[model samples]
Target chain A: MWKTVVRRLIIMIPQIILLSMLVFTVAHFMPGDPFTGIIDPNVDAARLEELRRAAGYYDPLHVQYFRWVGNALQGDFGRSFAQKVPVTTLIGARAMNSIRLGIVSTVFTYAIALPFGMLSGRYNNSWFDRFVMIYNYVSYAIPTFVLALLFIYIFGYQLQWFPTRGSASPVIPKGTAPYYWDMFYRLLLPGFTAGILGTATTTQTLRNEVIDAKTQDYVRTARSKGVPENVIYNKHIFRNAFLPIASSIGFIFSGLLNGSVFIERIFAFNGMGDLFITSITSRDYSVVITLVLFYGVISIIGSLVSDIVLSLVDPRIRIE
Target chain B: MATDNTLIEVNNLNVGFRFGDEYYNAVEDVSISLAKNEILAIVGESGCGKSTLATAIIGLHDPHNTRIEGEILYNGLDLTKLNEKLYNRLRGNDISMIFQDPLGSLNPVMTIYKQIEESLIYHTKLNDKERYDRVLELLNQVGIPKPERVMKQYPHELSGGMRQRVVIAIALANKPPVIIADEPTTALDVTIQAQILDLMKDIQEETESGIILITHDLGVVAETADRVAVMYAGQIVEEAPVDVLFTDPKHPYTRSLLNSIPNELHEDGEELHVIQGTVPSLQNLPRKGDRFRDRIPWIPDEAFDEDPILHEIAPGHKVRGNSWKYFHFEGEEME
Candidate 1:
């Protein structure tokens, strides 16, 4: 298992290098230059050359790439053009908040999708099953941004049950009961909208997988062996049904990382997505490239984790 | 654990399925009884309801979608009348089934030992140690080598024949009074098929449990079955002691089936006698005629009774309806 993880990590090295190279090439060719934002209109041509040369903008593409990659490896992502701060420092603070939400939303999505999906699939065509189908149809048809807006209007504006904007309220301090509770309370609307965004499609697919799993000959064998209906449903049928769902973990994990983009925007949360929007509009090349690479690394790691998880659940996969 | 001579008695049972507004009979009024240590093999062409009848006797059908009539008498109770809860108690403890497609018949994710342990866990009061030992013992009894290592393996790791052994081991783990083997050897190679039949025969003799072996192979029936019932198009056309039916078969379908068997005397390109017509689909089944009539159209009308019923013409032997006085196949009649 360790060997497999190590191998996957090793394979990810070239992928990251290739990806960074592509991004670097594109960033250089973009319509505007970073120096333009901070150009001294009064500076002599020689002074401008000094700034460009110091910034490594006058070097060959490969030289600039190696320098940036070397610094990135040491936890430096250059400086943001618009902010005039270390790109890492700018992203680090926002990245943490995004990750916390990512973890919560990931846990919430599966915790909600799995049990309900299996049950809804097992008792398909029943009233609850029909209700779940309708739920899937609604969640799928309406864009997630709209759902986020609806959630903000109903729960935040109308009901006054949750905070409509920001990561937390300012009244509570850190490490206190109200602070923790308030944080959770404040996250209710955005977190929920983000968590529920893609669950309908996932739940529906899981339901169909469960239904298909029940028809396998092994399930019938279990039934014939006098296994209780519930036991057969859970131990045999659900185990197989969960397989198809396991294959989707990488996508879910990736979604959790950036899946909150629209929700974060509507709720005014200053996370990666919020930073991403502002950075792109201001043409902050360093920050944009860092965010993209951050997302890419997380997704690759997610796929690796999913492979290990599936192999553990199914021995047939591990041996091969 | 009553040691009654009679084990399972399937009375005139009819199992039908509901499609839209119409109900289709898959297994027509069938009656058979199994005694201790008896092997009653149900033989037929594909879709002839052999498997369906066996499934019905085991209460595999749900009454919601399936319409069943008559009784499955076991231990003074009609199985058809028993609820799912009671059926659970009786199943695997008193009756178990060995399914077709052994590779697909055991849960792919579960270890072989766990699959066998299912019955022991449900039916026996033995602790984990005893259950574990019994599972290994079952694996040994089914002629699987190195049961200790095999216990840790999943279904896919084993060969088709080994998987079938695991299936048989599971079926026999509880020492159920009756076992239904539904085309158990159909998916196996010819040589492996012989080995499995031999193993079942030995197990049956040792336990003296009645087995209802469902298969389409007459060769298998001749080797292991004590008695045989020939089914065609949802009806049993003939049933008798294995030796008697093979010697003096009374139904035309049964006679045709016997004639189609190849032997060394046949030429390589010999046009094998083939039964011509397809079994009618359940939805289009004839309501008031011999189910096999369309397939044997050359036979005189006088030879067939308008409505065929199983009538005993000799001791312990019965033929359905009548086909003239004798059945002649392509001008060759076996008297």
Candidate 2:
């Protein structure tokens, strides 16, 4: 299994390189340069050309790529053109917030999905099952941003149950119990909104998996062995049912990260998603490329993580 | 038919499955019994409800979707009337089952030791060491080599034959009096099938457990069974001691089934006897009269009783309906 993990990591080297090239090329070809917002409008066209040349902006694409790659190898993503700080520094401060939000949302997703799916599957075609089915359909149909906004309106503004925007109260001092409590309280709405949006697929997948596992020949064997219904479900059914769901954990992680962009925008949360939008609009090429590359690497690692998880749970899946 | 040595008796057992709002009987009013130290083979083609009867005996059917009627009497208790909790105590302790597909029957993720130990855990008070020893013993009893090595491995690591043996070991864990093997060797190759059948016989001899061996293979029945019950549709159409059933198959369905088997006695150019038509689905089965009539159209309608029931033609020999008495091939005249 360690061998498999090492082999996968080795193979990811070329993949990451290719992904970096793609991200850089896409960012470079976009309409405006990073200097557009930074330089004065009254500056002469020759002066602007000198600035561009001085920055090596006139260099060939391959040269720029290699230069970027060389710097990237040394943990130097260059400075964000707009922020005037290292691209890594700009991202590091916000990445944690995004990760926290993603983690909270993931927790909510599984909390709502697992029991609901298991029960719905256990007592299939019952009223509770029907209710879950309806919930799945409605949740699947609604757009993530719309759901987030609706949640903010209902749970935040209208009911005054939770804070509508930002990750924490500005008044709360850092490193205090109250501050952590306030942070958790403020994280609820956006996390739940994003989390609820994700539940439909996980719930549906797990529901179908549970139903399929119940009918398997092993379940019958379990039953024939005089195992109690509860034990049969706990030992025989749930583990097998969770196999497919466990295998998709990496995809779920990547999805949550992608979803954070819209979720963070609506919540006005200071996360990677908020930074991403701001950087893109301001044409901070270095920051944008770094963030894109970070997301790309994360998604690649996510799949590998899920593979390891699946192999751990399912004895049949020998990674070697 | 409830003799002193009878292990289980099914009195007019009717197993039904629901389709939409309607309930259709899959096994209709079938009566049979298993005696101690005997192998009772229930032979039928697919869709004949042989499997349904087996599951019904073990009380394995989903209660919500299934409607099982009649009595499954075991040790003065009505198995049909037992709730899930009661059934749990009775199953694996008094009665156990071996399923058809060995690959699918054993839990893929569970180690062989855990699976074998499952029944022992539920039925016995054996501690960790005792359970561990019993697991290895069961594996060895089923003729599995390297019991110590195989115990730690999952179902996927074992071959098909090995897996079936593991399944048998699981069934034999508690030494249950009645073992319902539902086409136990059906999923195995011919050579493996023979080995599994032999293992079952050896286990039966040593344990003295009553075995209900359900299969479509007449060869398996002839080799291992003490008595044979021939099922057509959902009912037992013919039943007798194994030799009697094979040498003088009384039911038309039984005769047709026997004749269909390819043998060396057949001439080079002669065509094989094929039973016409397939077994009727539960929803389409004839609720009255001999259910096998449609497949043997050449047999005169007059020969079939309006409401056919098992009638004893000789001591320990029973056939359903009078049609078998008048049954003859289409090109042949009545003797």
Candidate 3:
């Protein structure tokens, strides 16, 4: 098992490099020029040419790609022409804000979905089961942007229950206890709205998986041994049912990131989503390539982690 | 033949499942008993309710839509009325079950030791260390060698014979007085089947625990059962001492079953005799008279009793009502 994980990691380095190369090629030829937007309009054509040359825009595409790749290998993601800061520093700070939302929403999804799924499945076709099914449909049908807006209106604007815009309070002093609480308070509405969508889909799907697991022979054997219903649900059934949930965690990170684009836009949460959009629209090649490559690495690591965790939970996977 | 010191007595057990507005009886009006140190094999083709009776003996029925009637008397207590709490106390300790598919009978994720020690944890008052030692001893008793290595192995790691041995080890873990084995050897090879049967017989002798062995294999019944009950369409059509069943089989169904087996007299690739038609499904199950009537048309209308009952023909020999009219063995009529 450890060998598989180690080998997977070893293989991932080349994969990540190939992925970075692909993103670099696409972003390089994406129409708008970063130097055209940043350089002064009054500058002479010769000086403008010099700036483009310095940025390696006039070099062959492969040459430019390899130059960027070479700098990236040494941990330099290049300086943003627009922001005038290293791409890593900008993305690093914002990634923390995204991480907070990602972690909390993930916890909420599993903590809420797992038990409710088990109950709905155990009592499949009951009134409560139908209610959960309907709830899943309704929550999933409402688009994430719409839900985010609704939550902002009801919980943020209409009710004054939470802050509507941005991630932290301007009034609270930084590094203070109140600032941390204020940050959490601001995230609650958007976080829950985003999290509940995942919870809804997962809970319903997990209910189905659990229903299937209940019919497995091991469950029948467990019952014959006189293991209590609750023990059977928790010990025998949930372990297998939760396999889908474990693998889903990987892609869900990327899903949540994609979802946050509009959510942060609507909520005014100045995180990676906002930065990504501003950089892309302005054709800020450095930040765009950096964020794009960063997301790719996250997805690869997420899948790897999911595989390893699944192997740990189910012994059958350990040897294979 | 004489059921003295009965360990588990099932009286007129009826198992039915409800679908929509209709209820279908899977096993109806069947009664049997297991005595101390005896092996009672209930033999029939697939879906004969042979397994249903075995599960019902341990107070296990379908999780939903199935109803059980009549009394399962163990220690003079009707197991039918026993609450799950009380049932739990007796189950895995007083009465245990081993199932048909050996692999499915044990949890795939659980180690052999954990599966074996499950009964010990539930039934015995032994500490973990003692349970561990007892598990190895029980493994050795079930004919598993190098039990230390086997204990840590999962069900998939072992062969079918080894898995069944693990299951038998679990059944014997608490030293239950009655063990219900539902087609325990059906999933194994012939040699392993014989070995498992012998091991069960040895266990029965040493512990004096009654075993209710449910199977469709007449060969298994002949080799293992002391008393045999031949079931047809949810009813016990004939039941007698093992010797009498093979020698003086009285029911038309029993006669046809014995003839279906390929024998040495037949040349290779000869078509075997098969009792015509399949067992009746739940919806078409006959509630009165002979359920096997359609399959044995040659027996004549007079052969089926107007009111069907498992009728005793002689000391320790029983057959379904009116089956005595046309009873024959190996094409020879009884005097």
Candidate 4:
């Protein structure tokens, strides 16, 4: 299994390189340069040209790409065009923020989905099952952004339960208990919104799987052994039903990143999603490309982790 | 057949499944008893409710979708009346079942050890060490080599025969008084099928447990069973000692089933007898009259009893309906 993970990591190197190249090329050919709107209108044309030339912006695409790649190899991703700070330094805190939200939201996703799905399936066609079905339909129909906005309006404005915008308060000192608590308190709305949005697929998948598992010959065998219904569910039905859902964790992880874009924006959370959008709009090429690469790497790792997890859960699957 | 040695007695049991709002009896008015150390084989084609009868005996049916009327008396206790908790106590402890598909019957993700231990965990007060030792003993008993190694391996790692043995091991874990094997060897190779049957017989003799062997294979019934019950649609049309059943099948369905098997005595180009029609679906099944009537249409409708019941032809042989007495094949004269 370790060998398989190592091999997967080796293969991912070239995939990440290709992705980086693609992001770079696309950003390079975008409509406007970094200086388009940010620079003063009265600046001398010659000075602007000289500045561009000095920054190697006029270099051939391959030359620029190779230089960037060469620099990136040494952990130097270049300075953000707008921030004038190294891309790594700028992304560090934001990436942590995104990951924190991602973890909490993922926890919420599974915690809500697993029980709901298992029970709904166990008591199939019951009121709870019908309610879950209704919930699934509603969650699926509403877009993540719309749901996030609605949550903000209701919980933030109407009820005044949670803070509406930003990840943390400026008043709270960093690394303190109250600061973390404040962060957590601020995280609930966005985290729950993202979590609820993510639950639809998993809940439906697990529910269907549980239903299928219930009719399986093995379940009957368990029942014949005089195993209690709850034990049969935990020992026989759950693991079998949960196998497919567990294998999908990688895809779900990648999906959460995609979902965070709308959630982070709506909540005004200073995370990778917000960073990504702002960098793209401002044409902060260095930060944008780096963030893209980060996302790509995360997705690759996500799949690997899911594969490892699947092999662990299902003895039938041997990674080697 | 004596009440003193009877392990289970199912009386006028009606096993039905719900379709839309109405209940359709899959196994209707079926009465049979299993004696200690006896192997009673229920023979029928697919969808004939032989498997349903096995499930009913084990109380494995889903109570929500299934309507089971009548008593499954195991040691004077009516299993049909037992709640889930009570049934749980009776199942795997006093009564256990082996299913048809070995691969499907054993949990794919679970190790053989865990699956074998599951029954022991529920039915026995044995601690971890004893259960572990018992699991190995069971594996050895089922003819699996290297019990230690095989116990750790998952179901998929084993062959079909091996998996079936593992399932048998699980069924034997509690040493229950009654073992219901529903077409247990149907999924195995012909060679393995015989071995499994032999193993089951050996286990039954050693444990002195009554076995209900449900199968469509006449040859399997002939080889393994002490008594045979031939089912048609949901009803048992004929039942007798195995030897008597094979030598003197009273029902048209039973005779037709026996005749269908190929033999060396048949001359070249002599076509095998094929039972005429398929068993009717549950919804379309004739709720009254002889259920096997449509399949053997050559027999006159006047010959059938309006409400067919098992009638003793001999001290030990019973045949359902009067139609069997007058039954004859097409293009043949009536005796």
Clashing pairs in 2: none
**Per-residue lDDT of B286-312 in model 4, one digit per residue for the tens?**
999988888878788789998989989
> Model 4, B293: alpha-carbon shift in Å?
2.9
> What tens digits encode model 2's per-residue C-alpha lDDT throughout B127-209?
99999989988888999999999999999999999999999999999999999999998899999998998899989999999
| lDDT against true structure, model 4 | 0.89
Which pairs clash in model 4?
Answer: none
Q: Against the hidden reference, what TM-scores do the models get?
A: 0.96, 0.94, 0.95, 0.94
**Cα lDDT of model 2 by residue, A88-194, tens digit:** 88888688888888888888999999998999999889999999999999998999888887888898889999888887778988989999999888778888888
Positional deviation of residue A228's Cα in model 1 after best superposition, in angstroms: 1.1
Q: Give the true-contact fraction for every prediction, in order.
A: 0.73, 0.87, 0.35, 0.95
| Pairs in steric clash, model 1 | B303-B324
Candidate 2: residue B140 lDDT (0-100): 85
Q: Please write out the lDDT profile of model 1 over residues B150-236, one tens digit for every residue.
A: 999999899999999999998998898899999999999999999999999999999999999999999999999999999988888
Cα deviation at A155, candidate 2, in Å, is: 3.1
Q: Could you give the TM-score of chain B for each candidate, in order?
A: 0.96, 0.98, 0.94, 0.98
Candidate 1 vs candidate 2: the DockQ winner is 1
State residue A149's C-alpha deviation in candidate 3, in Å. 2.0
Candidate 4 lDDT by residue in tens digits, A1-320: 67766776788888888887887887677675646656787999999999888988889889998988888888898778788788889998988899889988898899899999999989889999999999999998999888988988999999999999999999989999999999998888899899999998899999999999999999988998888889889879999999998898987877797679888988999999999999988878768878887898888778877887888899877754
Candidate 4 segments whose C-alpha is farther than 4 A from its true place: A31-63
Q: Model 1, which residues run further than 4 Å from truth?
A: A31-39, A175-177, B1-4, B264-270, B333-335
The TM-score of chain B in candidate 2 is 0.98
Candidate 4 chain B lowest-lDDT run of ten: B292-301
DockQ per model, Cα: 0.80, 0.79, 0.55, 0.84
Every candidate's lDDT: 0.85, 0.89, 0.83, 0.89
Q: Residue A88 deviation, candidate 1, in Å?
A: 1.2
